[model samples]
Target: MKILHVVDMISQQRGGGSAKVPYQLGEAQARLGHKVTIYASDFHAEDQLPPKGVELKKFHCALNLLGGVRITPSMVFADFSQFDIVHLHNYRTLVNIIAANKGRPYIVQALGSCLPINGLTIPLHNFIWRNLILKRASALIAIAEMEIGQYVAEGADSKRISLIPAGIKCNEFNRRPARVKDGKKRVLFLGRFHEDKSPVLLAKAIKILNRNDVILLMAGYDDGCEKTMRRQIKELGIEDKVDYIGARYGKDKADTYAMADIYIMPSRREVFGLTLLEALACGTPVIATDRCGVASLLPPECGLVVPFDEYALAKAINEALDKDIASSYREYRIKWAKQYDWSKIAPKIIEVYRKVLGT
Candidate 1:
């Protein structure tokens, strides 16, 4: 099957699930003997290398509009019908709206963007796309069971929505043996340094913990909140405990995860915590907010699911790094993450596409 994946951008450093999901899914789909082509903006395109068996078509961003929507006028002239089916990632984008009306049976994996977010330009974007895209979509990919109602509320038929979780390549992360490392208990927060990801909250949690031995390895691309987080870290007098390591990829990311005693994701709202899987795949114990879709899948033996609160996150971090559970979690998490491997999840996605095409 020939598949077209339409996404806002293919830049992994953009530090959003939508940015990474399309390429990773496309890579996996291509690996399964399907031809996959990706259409996205050239934003940080150099930072990403498309996986083998995938073709990437990058269009120049003609206009950066309200809400950072990269308007690619070239999409208007591009051929979207050549593919057997199309998959749209990240809702509320101008390119997605254009591609949705291109007469191809395209499914939407909104990546939690379908939730009624009343952002600056979301209403206008939704108003333009509601009929052309969501209503006319072949299927809606819901990453979390919690997102089913969100799609239904957006005037989608529940039957047209398929619950599919994002997958990780277990081989991408090098699994470290469960051994005791002599160093400060490193707690990693390795995603967007943005408010939605709650990096500031994690900083506060670190401040609240007031621990001398534990260090916060705050890493990733700055999504407009690094200054605020850095200031807060300084204001809270925890600068010595927090290290700001900018953007890690490939081997660096896997080693970063493996080096940490605990990985914490304190997202206020999340569809699926992909980093949780990445961290777990590296045999790193994780703590994510209950809002994450992956939080439910993690057992107490390997991970901890906490609420979006500093005290709760602080406690979870402490418990995750505890001597008794930490060693055991490191050993068990690698086994736990193997179940959601992309090799297994890609076939389920192909099933959705085949069903849409009546194959």
Candidate 2:
């Protein structure tokens, strides 16, 4: 099978997870003896090319000022008929509009953008997705079942939707021995710092818990919410308690995972918290909000789920650090993480490809 993978920008600049998915899938599909070509933007440097049987096609795109996501121009839309199947990953910008207008049968791997509450750009995005993209899709792949509801609400055809969770390369984030807290436990928040991500709320919750023995390690780039979060941290007098580690990727990201005692994500909205899966696979117990799509897949014993409230989040955090909580649940999370590796995910994705391509 010859497959063309499309997206807005396929660089590390957009962060790791989305970029990693296509690269990993391309590699796997190529290994299984299929041809794969990735279409990405030059603005986002290529992290890794498709494997032996795959190809890379780079195009130029115009950058959207506010979101920083790129738009694919009409010129890039030519030559859509070359591939057996066109698979799109996170190509929700004008790039998707171009692809849809090309009038080719395509599969949309909708990551999370279709959710209304996830962005303020909903009105315009709705127009683009409804009028331009979803209607043209042969299949709309959702990361999780919980994530499919939003698409359904948007009037997407039920039969066209398929739920497939994002795959984690387990070996990269192999299970580590549970860290026993000595003095201060290291808590990691790995994702862009934004209101939706709720880093400020996490800081406040930690302060309310008054767990001086726990040091909050905030990782990832500040996505326009640094000043607001910094102010909140300062007001709560948690300036000393919180350490911002900025953005990390590659082995640095894995090492950051290795150093943490627990993973905390207090995000208010999540289609599928890919970081949640990454942390669990690293053998770190997770504490997250009810809204996380991955939360349902969490082994009941691996972590605790709470409401998005500060108090509930704080309680879950405190519990996650408890010796009893860690001891009783550690193995369960490790076992659960082992089940959804990239190796397992690869074949499933191929099956979807075959289905969409009618092969």
Candidate 3:
């Protein structure tokens, strides 16, 4: 099968999970003997190229609007009919509209953008996108079951939607062995430093813990919230307790997950928290919000799932630290994450593709 993947950008440092998912899925598909080509605006240099097997066609973006939507002529002019299926990564983009107009059978992986969390205009945008564009697709890939209702509400046919969780390279994270109590516990918050990510809440939670022995590693790209986060940290006087390591990837990313005793994701409105999966895959327990789609996948013994509140988060963190479950649960966490491996997940996605293509 010849598959074409269209996304705005494909950079490890900038694109985050949205870029990584399609690239990884494309690689997985290629390993299954499918010819996959990813089309994106090449914002990164040659040093930051995508993985092998999946072909990448880079184009320059003429303009970027509304923070994420890119206007690329290359995408508009691309021959969509050349591929058996065109898979779109995100919606509300000019590229997606162009693809919709191209008369090819395409599939849309909403990537949490379909949820009407942004504002009134976004809901309207999504409603129109779903009714006019997405409804015509061969299928709509819902990363979480929670998102299926949102798609249905937006006028998508229920039967046209398929639930497929985003997958991770489980082996990439080097799982840690049972650790001896070193008197110091490390709490990690690894993702975009944004308001929606609720980094401020995590900082506040760390302050409430008031523990001298615990260190919080706040690492990720700044999404216009660094100043606010720094201000909050200073106001709360937890500067010494937190270290701001900007954007970690590859071995460094894996090592950070392995070293951490507990990983915290306090996102207020997350569609799916991929980092939570990575943390568990590395044998590190997680404290994620109930709002995140990843929370649904977690078992009670794996980690704590709390509401989106600073006090609740702080309490969960404190309780997680007090329990000596890390060593005992290390094997369980790794075993649980194995089911979400791309090797296992890709076959499910291939099944969806085959059904869509009627092959």
Candidate 4:
């Protein structure tokens, strides 16, 4: 089957969860003998193309002068009839809206943009999605059931909507037996340093816990929010307890996970966090928020799930540290993460492609 995956950008570093999902799925599908072509923006030279087996098409996501307002190209005005399935990623720009109206079998994978944060854009995007795309779509894939509910509320056909959780490459996050070290309980927060990530909350939780032996490793680019987080740490008087290692990915990410005793994600909202899976696959127990879709993967035996409150998070952290259940929980984490491996999940996507194209 010929599949066209449309997204705004394809760089792994753009720090958008949506970009990772489609790229992972597209690559896996291509590996499985499907013809996959990705349409992404050339924002960074490093993000110009995808890996082998998938053809990457470049497009400019720059601004056009329409009375000095920055706007994306209209998708409703593009030609999109070449593929059997048009899977739109984070291409929620004007170009996608134009392309959606094109006569093709459409499927939208909502990463996390459809939440209330978009305000009036939700209604407007929905109007175009429902009346223009969803009404004519072959299917719509929602990463979480919560997202599926949102799509249904916007009048999307329930039959056409599938709650398909994003799959991680298990080998990329597999347990390393030799790297475990016994030391102070380390709480790691490895993600974008954004307001939604709520890095300050994790810092505040560490401050409240007041565990001198517990260290906080905040790894990722601050993107200018580091100063605010530093102020919070200073106000809480835990500056000495936190270490900021800016922006580590790939092997550095794996090594950090290898050393950590616990993985913490205090995100206020997460559709499905890939890092959560990465942590679990590394045999590291997690203490994630109830709002995170990744928390669904956490059984009581594996880790703790708490509300976004600092006290609640701190309490969970203490409980995890005090129990010394690392070995047992690590075993459970590895077993649990293996079930969601892309090696297993990719087949379902291939089946979806075949079903959509009737090949």
lDDT digits (tens) for residues 32-140 of candidate 4: 8888888766554244457568887766657634321224464334457778888887424554565566777777776765553356667776666567755676777
Identify the runs in model 3 with alpha carbons over 4 angstroms from their true place.
Answer: 44-47, 117-128, 177-182
Candidate 2 clashes between residue pairs 3 or more apart in a chain or in different chains: none
Candidate 3 scores a C-alpha RMSD against the true structure in Å of 2.1
lDDT by residue (196-266, candidate 1, tens digit) is: 88898898899888888898998898777888888888898999998888888888889888888888889
Residue 54 of model 4 has an lDDT of 88
- Per-residue lDDT over 1-359 for candidate 2, one digit per residue giving the tens place of the 0 to 100 score: 78778766666545456676777778777877777888776665645354456687777665655676675564464687877878888746666777767766788887777755457877886677776888778888888887678778777887988887887767778645545457778888998878889998899899988977889999987778988999989999989998888787767777787678788889887878878877777677788888888887676677878898999888878877776454455556766886677677777877877787678
The true-versus-predicted C-alpha distance at residue 9 of model 4, in Å, is 1.7
TM-score per model over all chains: 0.94, 0.90, 0.94, 0.90
For model 3, what is the error of residue 71's alpha carbon versus the real structure, in angstroms, after optimal superposition?
Answer: 1.1
Candidate 4 stretches with Cα past 4 Å from truth are 45-49, 64-79, 117-126, 175-182
Cα displacement (Å) at residue 232, model 2: 1.1
After TM-score superposition, the amount by which residue 253's alpha carbon in candidate 4 deviates from its true location, in angstroms, is: 0.9
Write down the lDDT of every candidate, Cα atoms only.
Answer: 0.84, 0.76, 0.84, 0.75
